[model samples]
Target chain A: MDNKLSEICKQLDQLALDILKLCEEQVKCRVKLEEAMKPGFVHIAKSRYIMGNRTVCSLQLPTEDSAEFDALTTVVPQESITDSEHRGFKLVETPKGQDTSGKSVLRRRKEKPESDASTEAKEENVKTYVDPIKWFGVLVPQNLKMAQNCFQSVLPLVVECANVQGELQRVQMKYQKLLKEKELLS
Target chain B: MAIHSAIKGKLISVIGDEDTCVGFLLGGVGEINKNRQPNFLVVDKHTSVGEIEECFKRFVKRDDIDIILINQNIAEMVRHCIESHTQPIPAVLEIPSKDHPYDASKDSILRRAKGMFNPEDMK
Candidate 1:
């Protein structure tokens, strides 16, 4: 009977360890999902600009307020210029090391000589300097949803891990008690 | 658990002795796979810092990798590369090796936590 009890206790200990391992595994999975979802926080810094069908949302760093917009102009890549009338926009690369502050600076290259009559050649050249807008900052809704799902999915696993840890503690206490009893009996 | 997922599908490129890498491998702690996601990579001690840094630069650019685990000793060698990374992805975690056990006094996380909880005690 004593031998049978010892075997049963051993089995219980193994079961507890297995449960603990499973719980740990679940917790790990949850954490990884959380890390992947971190970029979704960029939504907190979102800025939106709409031009026809192109609705651009920008995430301003440090803070999301429009007040911080000036600071972001330096950081964002300059791809194109937009005019106040929302027309005559031209694609030009911003000069390197040029500071974007106070008055806007405009440097237009000398007009090239046109040899042949082409529709592209007839286009007007307007020198306008608009602040470079940061385009990548928009909070991706899909990423945010995925992050939420990951957080929810990990909750059960965390509970299981806790339960297993609790069971292990109980078994450890019982094992100690049994050892003491055996010592007294001997 | 947070540590595990932060490193999932990400490569943990280590540069140290064989024993240290083996110890971690035996512990079954690195490179956990989940829900059809690709298994995280663990570069053993044999890899070089340059190779690791190059991989790190590329890894951070990718959406797949979230965390990077490196032996602290090896990380120290390429501190500039590690510090200069702009992307928040592939968060770098420095771990102790078999030869060098983790010293709380030297760990930045512990130092930061201590500063937050017991500001006076730090002095």
Candidate 2:
């Protein structure tokens, strides 16, 4: 009897997890669309433009306090703030050496191109970087990072979905038990 | 009931082709438990039926896995074992692979479920 009850519970548990997975997928799609609608969220064409033989990669300014249509010129090589004033638009400097969890989903450039090397070195610790290959070039870094944050932030939504699934399963199990009990009684 | 506690640690196991296994692994469902055992099995062209059967048996016996997702096509290869498995926990689900989409007609569970009711029950 206990075995049968537990088996039912186990099925319920599996269904609950499936509910959570589906809810997460739906939330991701909707959140990505809404996030994309925000100002400075969309990357302009100027960033990846090629000039002459050299492909000049222009990084966007940190959009926190930027006006509409605020953009950037090419980043200074040594990353001196002095060059900011000389350049037409402000260049939000990429942080040199800090690894911020859940933010700045920046890939290590050609300097650390061996993909596994940096990850392996950090393997000893609880590494928080999402597997790079998962979303490497799919969404731009800013959009991807924002989507990740939104996903984590809305975990409660997934939890709620799981709770509802659990309740529904419990009701189902009880209904089955009642039917079985009635059969035995008769 | 106490045995259920031992099985409550949630993890997803997989028995699938390269594309299916790689897709789930990339989704961050892959894990190597403390015993250095992976929760996934990648079935390649060189993989034998015996090896696939052994891995399926091992995954079914595992306490941590709450779900075992098998590519529907590969599940067809081990239909006997799948048909015999009655446990509701470690629920085995059939998923579509890149090369092969799911066919409801070939699903063992669905076939078994259909057998449970009388012709009158359908009405």
Candidate 3:
């Protein structure tokens, strides 16, 4: 009983440390976010201009338990760069969080096969990707970009916080169970 | 959950004051589905507790939403609803808004974790 209790105690201690570290990260992210927003207030204070109904980027959800969380990946239109007949939005995964090498991976997700096979069917499969930043204005100030970067950085941190919180909850339950067993044994 | 495979990617939904939504949306986390349903809710002084609860419940029900980032103050307003959520998927994260800073003492998950530590044990 004493051995089990000690083990639970160790786990609890580790979790406590992890939570503290996560809190520190959260604070730093919050500060950065606040700093990032400072510029937006001066440049894009018009509530109507900033408000938009659509999102151009989507988070690549973790598929497996061990999968690394990803930041929102936005597909930029290559209309100006290329006049290619096939105007499919290229999905590029930005290098953030664990991707320390800082190389953006140009990868595309497999699209669902269409039922009707027509030449126009190819166009139907293509999604028009709009840059979310454009929602603000054509000529947005650098502050808006900074705010986006700050918020983008917070995604992985939020995921880590959630994972640690889950672990702490599990260990807390185990500790409680062990305590009950120890009392009964005594 | 199997449907997650067919979908391209998941979304991080937001439920907070106007500033929080605007800031994060600029980060490119906002999305309106084919159903014309937005993944975020902008709460103002006119926004009621019931409205917040309703939007939160809606976010919880959304399969495409993997994370819900709500302002800590708004989360407190809907604490009962937040507590009832037990699933690990679609994590409900209480973040600090510009107006109200984050208070760890009021966080549901952090508060529960804190309870596990007894002062006597430290000694």
Candidate 4:
């Protein structure tokens, strides 16, 4: 009887260890899956910041009034447009008649009203004007996803931990009850 | 499911009875209101509306608080406070109380969905 009781105790200890290991493995697997799904960056327009691997200002060209400046340019500025242009800020005339360049081919293809020449010239002027500075930041989708998953993954673990804790409490209580019963019988 | 990095170390304490606040507290998410000024507060059925409102006012004033979770029943009493808080931090959430059922009409989720689906009806 003593040998059998010792064997059962060893088996129970092994089972507990296995359960804990399994729980850890499950958490690890879930974390890997969650890491793959994270977004590159959380762009907060209100804060004018991109939060990802690190917090960075969303503006490509860093400027004091970047938000306000970006807001002003509804049309794509010509100076800012980088294709195969004048490498480091060069004044280039807007192709007025027909642009052979593949980069501007799509824009040139669009039909414009003959009456809108003045408007077109005005737009071109706005594009050609150079402001020289750009603010931008690299956003890591993995970091964003990892952050999100961190919160989501906690819920199940918490529930499982609670359940296991409750079970352990019940098991202890039952063991105590059985010991009392044995005492009473003896 | 943002990582809630802002509120992680800071206390997001909950106040009230076992049934109402325990679930969130046990989940290891929000802080429990233990009479101390918490970054986030969760008020339950046992917590009075006046107490909740007073705490909420304090929470809104504090820069640290990011969110507040209050029992929907208790929130009904302090509707003015809930409506008036324009600050981004200390966003008030009306959750279901233990005794009272979660009413879709009062809940923000349902309200937002309704607004999205039937915007014209709202007018």
Candidate number with greatest TM-score: 3
Candidate 2 interface RMSD, angstroms, 1 decimal: 18.3
- lDDT string for model 2 (A45-132, tens) is 1212312112211111111232111001011112237563111111121222222333323433235546696686664333232342
Displacement of residue A41 (Cα, Å) in model 4 is: 36
lDDT of 4 by residue, A42-147 (tens): 1122122334322422122222322221111111111225463211111112223222223244556877667488887764433211221112223433433343
Q: What TM-score do all the candidates reach, one by one?
A: 0.27, 0.44, 0.63, 0.31
* List of clashing residue pairs for candidate 3: none
Q: For residues B5-114, could you state the per-residue lDDT of candidate 2 as single tens digits?
A: 22223565678875445434433445554355767788878889999899999999987665677877899899998888765555576655556655656765545433
Q: Which stretches of model 1 miss by more than 4 angstroms?
A: A1-186, B1-17, B26-47, B86-88, B103-123
Model 4 achieves a DockQ score of 0.03
lDDT of 4 at A172: 38
Off by over 4 Å in 2: A1-186, B1-9, B120-123
Question: How high is the lDDT of residue B86 in model 1?
Answer: 34
Task: For model 2, name the residue pairs that clash.
Answer: none
Tell me the TM-score of candidate 4's A chain: 0.27
* Model 1 chain A: worst 10 consecutive residues (lDDT sum): A69-78
**Span of 10 residues, lowest total lDDT, candidate 3 chain A:** A55-64
- Predicted complex 1: DockQ: 0.02
A1-186 per-residue lDDT for model 3 (tens digits): 787766656665665576556555545554554455455443334433454322221222111232122334433222335554322222223333333112222222444365457735764443333345655556665656766666665555555555455444555565566555544654
* Clash-forming residue pairs, model 1: A32-B5
Please give the fraction of native interface contacts (Cα pairs under 8 Å between A and B) kept by each candidate. Answer: 0.00, 0.02, 0.21, 0.01
**Real interface contacts reproduced by model 4, as a fraction:** 0.01
Candidate 1 recovers a fraction of native contacts equal to: 0.00
